[model samples]
Target chain A: MTELNELTIAEARDRLRKGDVTSVELTDACLSAIEGAGALNAFVHNTPEIAREQAAAADARIAKGDAPAMCGIPLGIKDLFCTKGVPSQAASGILEGFTPEYESTVSQKLFDAGSVMLGKLNMDEFAMGSSNETSVYGNAVNPWRRGNDETALTPGGSSGGSAAAVAADLCLAATGTDTGGSIRQPAAFTGITGIKPTYGRCSRWGIVAFASSLDQAGPMTKSVRDAAIMLEAMCGHDPKDSTSADLAVPDFEAALTGDIRGKTIGIPREYRMDGMPEEIEALWQEGIAKMRDAGAKIVDISLPHTKYALPTYYVIAPAEASSNLARYDGVRYGHRAKLEAGDGITEMYEKTRAEGFGHEVQRRVMVGTYVLSAGFYDAYYNRARKVRALIKRDFEQVFADGVDAILTPATPSAAFGLGEMKNADPVQMYLNDVFTVTVNLAGLPGISVPGGMDRQGLPLGLQLIGKPWEEGELLNCAYALEQATGFVEKPGKWW
Target chain B: MSIDTETAAKVAKLARIRVEEDALPALAQEFNTILGFIEQLNEVDVDGIEPMTSVTPMRLPRRVDEVNDGDQQAKVLSNAPDAREGFFAVPKVVE
Candidate 1:
């Protein structure tokens, strides 16, 4: 029999509903699995007590036949989401020992829908960095090793822990926040499915902000159908988030008809970067063929401004980051360094922030401040915004040409070693976000589905960028692609 | 587009992050690399393109300016590093 911990959210839900298995049994199995997988460093804080409590409640609800789809499901939450009374740091020293008094909208919704909390997972500090190396809790190692090399690889970030946990079977599914490829890139690296919905599709009231305009939360799961179902449960309007869209939630699971009979999938010509690895290119072609086999018309499209997406994203994201992070002074909440007499308020703020933030967070904050400064505002910030508009227009033009979704390689390559990128130039590290950032820049819904593996046998993913507010149709297209590819290889647990 | 140590110091101070003197050179170099990457944006002509503030084409939803709920000071102060008498306590700013 498959271990209870190995079951997908959908499978566990079915078992719990039919009384074949109880929520408590599944929760205990996951707790033991997480306990044994400490070498992965996926979970930073374990709430076995809370997990049991929720599981018992869920079993009661299941017995009463009053449970939702996510009821009795155990999940790991990316440390970015504020779970009340839980240590809700975004894996940043500044937020160390800080527990939120209220639950973030997304996590609260998950709990309200009957999901059990297994623990808080690790992530990049302040949701920065492409690799999990910047996490205050240390790196969450990828379970997928490159054929006995033993060089622990990265699971991508700032949703690194979310991806690692779900991929390692530490949790059935995990909540992840993506501000410019945090969700999709990590999901690709870890060989799980992740979706970043259209901006405002989910409320972001309590998820720690990192580039407010770009940050959107979604689910990372073992399968595409699980992603669709969790995404529907995770999305809805909230009064606390002013930007949350006032729209009705759809039955995303029902929409996954697995038929793309009359759809048109666009292949953006610009995604074929110079010197892309042959494997990634081949995997993308395979994805295109799979979609074509599913009865979808494939058309070549042009997103002319694609080359400028990274730089445009950097300027805009960091500028917004600097402003959003200004609230983290040595004030009412979070870490505050000890101060000596006559060490005035300025010193207090400077010392607290400098001591609290990691190197990358401070670097981005400085860059953001510099770009938004008076002298460079029009040249950098404003110019990036205009370029962003052009980038959005590029997508708009393609969609207007009657394309249902656009297909591209999720990442340039497969899982890389943890310290492999440490000494390289930061710009090179930022290059990992190259293919994934454009979707965030446009605020469109995007999903990364595992397409195939590389020569070394590490997983690679294909991304689907969908029309704004058309996630249901987008998920169906992804389902068709997923069925045709049938790539469901889970990482062999070496941890 | 290159950044010097002096400009790097200025930017760090402006952002309220302390950078040691020895680190300024490295910071300046990193800034140069980032600026160089961003310079690629200059090649694209964005004439007549309005800046995209958001992807959703909706007006900011406004609510009536009235107190919906409040008075839970304990919950608000639960996470504070220092709290006193239903308020957050910070160092004195003025004599």
Candidate 2:
């Protein structure tokens, strides 16, 4: 039997389909791997018995010659997504015992495709922190490092667990959500491939939303092809999500064309900031060189409004988050604070909310309330929205200027030591998403592919920002780059 | 602008979050720090610019005026800590 840790989702599926391997065996191997790697803190919950039963059902389907694309694959689900009968805490103490009766659209689709659920992965509380340290269950450590170097590195947040699980070979792939670089940043940190499709491409029906307008669900996998295959299984229009697009779902697997001859690729001048690290710059240049060698034309373009993206996102995302999170009152679902006899309804609300939300979640809610307040709405929220519009317009102008897509570094630098920037104020962390957030604001598709590693052997990623609904072209370009760079193998130490 | 502890307490109350009286000073400090960061926007020349509500500048398609959802009262209240007769039960607010 091939080691479960080394097999990609595609390889595992092919073997399972041909009766070379059974879903039960693959799931058992994954469960054993999880048990061995318990120190990594990748999972918040594990359901071995449940996974076995699901795998048995998948095997029965295969025997009957009826199986979906992702049938029988063992996968880790980020805990933020609602799984019926399974507790879906956003890794926060507030929602300690909350369990949803209905599954999230993404989770339901995956289960319907015969994907076996290994368990719920860990994450930062309410997907707030960048270091994954804010998780109530504890942080997920990166699985890669030099020999005997025990300095724990952050697997990135708030999808840190998903990335760590995929990296540690605990599962073939995992579901991840991106709101201001959550999915792509973690994937970059853990040396995996994650794609954040265009806004509304995937349904957000039951995901515990952090920032409703910005939150998007995507796939995290070891290779670009696996990501594409998983994405095809996860995406579709849902009538429940009013924002879900009615556009035709393209066959993402078939879209993986290893051809980029004569494509116009834009190297945005704005991405080259004044304080970018030398290694990141070198990696960006290496990515451009590879693409150029693949018969693509590279052009220097300016997004003059690039500097405003982070500030605008901070304002808008918090404003929406404040509203979306209002559902967590003590009267409804989630944790309720113990109240005295004299305490009234208002006091109940105050106590419950104060006890339920974490510092970062509270900070966002406060900022959101302040911005949306009667007097300040026009000054802060309104003005930030205008800046967001200008940023989107900037992308449109660049695309109009014959640029097929934009290539830049996924993050400003490789994953820093855990807790390195956790206390350096919020703007510092918000600045980390400067390159990735603008694409979300523009409602366009963006992807992160493994570019190469930095000097310290930490992984680096190259980001591709495509025109709205142009994920097909973006994936083709990424496949071309993935083949040319050939950086898909796991880190030696991680193995 | 400097935010005092009392004002910070009021902000917390208005936000429906409770903070211990002793913790008010720290909350006040954090609020002032965040306000200070937001003050940076004043330096940017946004004069004569129209405020934008969305990045795409496209209005979402409006549905016809009709009742659509909110019929799943049992499902909605199923997760509640205390629900009575299909409604959230809370302490009395009347005098």
Candidate 3:
């Protein structure tokens, strides 16, 4: 039997509508679960007072018999999102004690829909690292262990906390932002579902900037249907964001008819990376087989520029980050370093940023500054931009040829132990995004669904990349794959 | 091209992040490894390809030139490190 806290968003919405459950009871269940699972370190900031108030309000809204699907549902908001009057640090020391006066556009949409805010979820500092190790709040441990091994594992990052919280049932669902696979990778590691919608699908107005062009906020939830339901609430055209697409938000949940009959699902040949784990390869074969069984045509497609995606991302994301992060110069808000005598504004800026940002963040800023420098701009930044065009064109070509969706392994392998890759070079860590970054580069929608388990009993996820602005179709394909695979395994409550 | 400690120092200064003199060699080496990895992009022949300014084909949305939000100076300055006289207080800029 599923606990109240463990209920998926779709199930909870129905139960609440039928008067089988109350929002306050659900909130208390999640709060108690969060309190008991302190070792996970997923939720860095708890707002029980606000949660209770919102629960009461959600209960009243439901009593009116006009509540939305997310009404009375509790969700953990990612720290990357600016929640009104809540500490909205991006897990960076630079943002210590900082709170937003207004809610992020996406979070406000969720609030307006009557979802109760649970608390702030932890993430990598400025969403830079692949593992949660770079977080100022430390690691958000994965709820799953490798066949009873006591050694803790990373729930992936920079949405590690969202993945962990959802997997551990700390919240029914959580919000996550993906720039180069932050949401999907962590979701893959923690055995949950995460979707990075098309870049302009969700408004980026009030969300803290990472890589502006690549960053997108999407739902991290227990199942694809929940993702579809929550994504409709999270996405819409917003005049607040200049990049926000002026498109209609479809009823994504209704689009899940579980019928991908005769739809073409492409298996991209280039995603078959060298030195990939045997289990991941096996999982990809399983996904393809399941899709074929679901009556979807499986075709071998090629995205030739796939190998160059990570390198291009490293260039563009950092260049934009350095420019975006320059605003945190110790004057307006957030951490301001203590200055010694004879220090001016320049010294202040230098000292504050050096002290405020973590090692990975600083390294990225330094690399960003270098690539955008006067001498290297054309060679590094501009060249990468042109290559990015190629990468985007590669997907456009495949989709233009009538490919509905593409399937690949979400991560090269399942979750790894904490600090396992700390000693490896940073590029070694970056390889984790090799499969998912291409979708971001092409500004396409991508969803990661837990497919099957590895030999160690750890879960592995299969990713489906869809054409631009076709998340509904993509989620349907993922839903069909989900039904075919029947992946209903939950992580043991070790935490 | 491999970055040296001197180049790394220059990059750090340019980024306005302080790196101790002893840390320069390590930072430079780290940059070297990353730059080496990034060098893979140089192999792609992108000579005539247009640099992608936007991923989705959309022109920048134009809005009427008007201030849509204002007032609440307290909220604006609420999170500032130092605020005085309804303005952000900064360290002295001129001698």
Candidate 4:
């Protein structure tokens, strides 16, 4: 029998309605599991008290016979989303001891829907790095290990902790934000499901900003069906966030009919990188074969500007990050430098920021400052923005031509050992987002579904990119893909 | 385009982060490597293309310029590292 902590949100909901289990029992099971799993470093902040209180309230709600789908469900929130009275530092030293008086719009929605908060999960500082190593709370270790090897692999980051927790069944599911593949790449790395909905599908009101134009919040789960259920609960129109779409939240769980008979799935030729591993290639082909056998028409498509996505992203993301991060000036809130007798305001700003930020965060800030500098703005920032248009246009043209979804490999490789690439060039780490960043730039909905395992027995995933603002349709395509692949592998409990 | 140590120092100052003089060389080298990678954008022809302002084509939803809520002075200053008399305290700016 599956452990209570391991039950999917859908299962837990059904059992909850039938009175087979109370949420407090499930919460206790998860809290005990988290206590035993310290090696993963997944849950940075444990809120068992808050969780128990919320779970008890959920039980009371369900007893009244009017509970939503997410009622009684426990979840791990990424540290980026500020929870009222929780130390939401975005895993940065700059925000030490700083707690917010308000909750982020996304977290509030989940709570109002009767969900329980497990705790704040770990992440890259300011959501800047592709690996979780840059987190001030320490890196979140991937629960999945290579066959018989003892090396600790990364959970692929900035949402690394969310991926680790979901993969290890530490929580039912966790919220993740994807700005150029933080959610999808980690989901692929840890053998789970993650979807980055259309850019404005979820509100970003109180979440820490990385790149304003690209960052989006979505669900990371054990199955595509859970992603659908949780995503419906997480998204809606919020007047607090200007970018959030003022549209009706559909019953996403109802859209998963598992009948994608006549959808057109596009196979983009440009995603075939030169040095990609054969296992990833085989995984992509397997997804294509599975979708074709499910009666979906597969056609070869061209995304001509795909090769330039990463370089363009590095330019734009850092440039925006430099601007957004300017708020940490040792004033108003967060860390402040100790001042000498002769020190002035400028000196205080310099010392505080230097002491607060990690090396990767500092590097990106410098890169951003350099690109947005007067001399290079037009060459680096403006040119990249124009290329961004072309990239988005590529998706629009394809979708306009009746391509319902695009299929590709989620990551270029499986999870690497922690510190494996630390000695290598930073550009090597940036290459990991190659296949996943285009979805963000084009502002399209994308889902990473675990399809198969690598030779090392690490999990591999296939990504399905869908049209903008059509996540229900995308989840259906992903549901059909999940049914065809039937990937149900779980990570062994090493932690 | 490559960055020198002097330029790196200038950027660090501009960004309000202090990079020690000894660390400037390493910072400049990292910048050059990233900038060199980003040079791939120059190969694309964007002669008449307009830079993208927003990914979605919708007009910005403008609200009437009015204060919807405020008056929480204690809540706003609660997270400050240094606060005094309902205000954030900082280093002396003027003599």
Best by lDDT: 3
lDDT for A45 (candidate 3): 94
Q: TM-scores for chain B, in order?
A: 0.88, 0.87, 0.95, 0.96
Cα shift from native, residue A109, model 2 (Å): 1.1
DockQ of each: 0.78, 0.58, 0.91, 0.90
Among residues 3 or more apart in sequence or in different chains, the pairs in candidate 1 whose N, CA or C atoms overlap within 3 Å are none
Model 3 chain A: lowest-lDDT 10 consecutive positions: A486-495
Residue pairs clashing, model 3: none
Kindly report which residue stretches of model 2 are placed more than 4 angstroms away from their true locations once superposed: A492-495, B43-75, B84-87
Candidate 1 vs candidate 2: which has greater DockQ?
A: 1
Q: Please, what is the whole-model Cα lDDT of each candidate in the order they appear?
A: 0.92, 0.85, 0.94, 0.93
- Candidate 4 has a DockQ of 0.90
Give lDDT: candidate 4, residue A295: 94
The TM-score between candidate 2 and the true structure equals 0.95
The predicted structure with the larger lDDT, 3 or 4, is 3
Candidate 4 structure quality by residue, lDDT tens digits, A1-495: 999999999999999999999999888888988989899999999999999999999999999999998999999999999999988999999999889999999999999989999899999999887789999999899999998899999999999999999999989999999999999999999999999999999999999999999999999998888999999988999988888889898888899999989999999999999988888889889899999999999999999999999999999999999999999998977889888899999999999999999999999988999899998999999999999999999998999999999999999999999999989888999998999999999888999999899999999988999998899999999999999888888887767
**Chain B, model 1, TM-score against the native?**
0.88
DockQ of 1: 0.78
lDDT value, residue B77 of candidate 4 = 94
Task: State the lDDT at A120 in candidate 2.
Answer: 96
Give model 1's TM-score for chain A to 2 decimal places.
Answer: 0.99
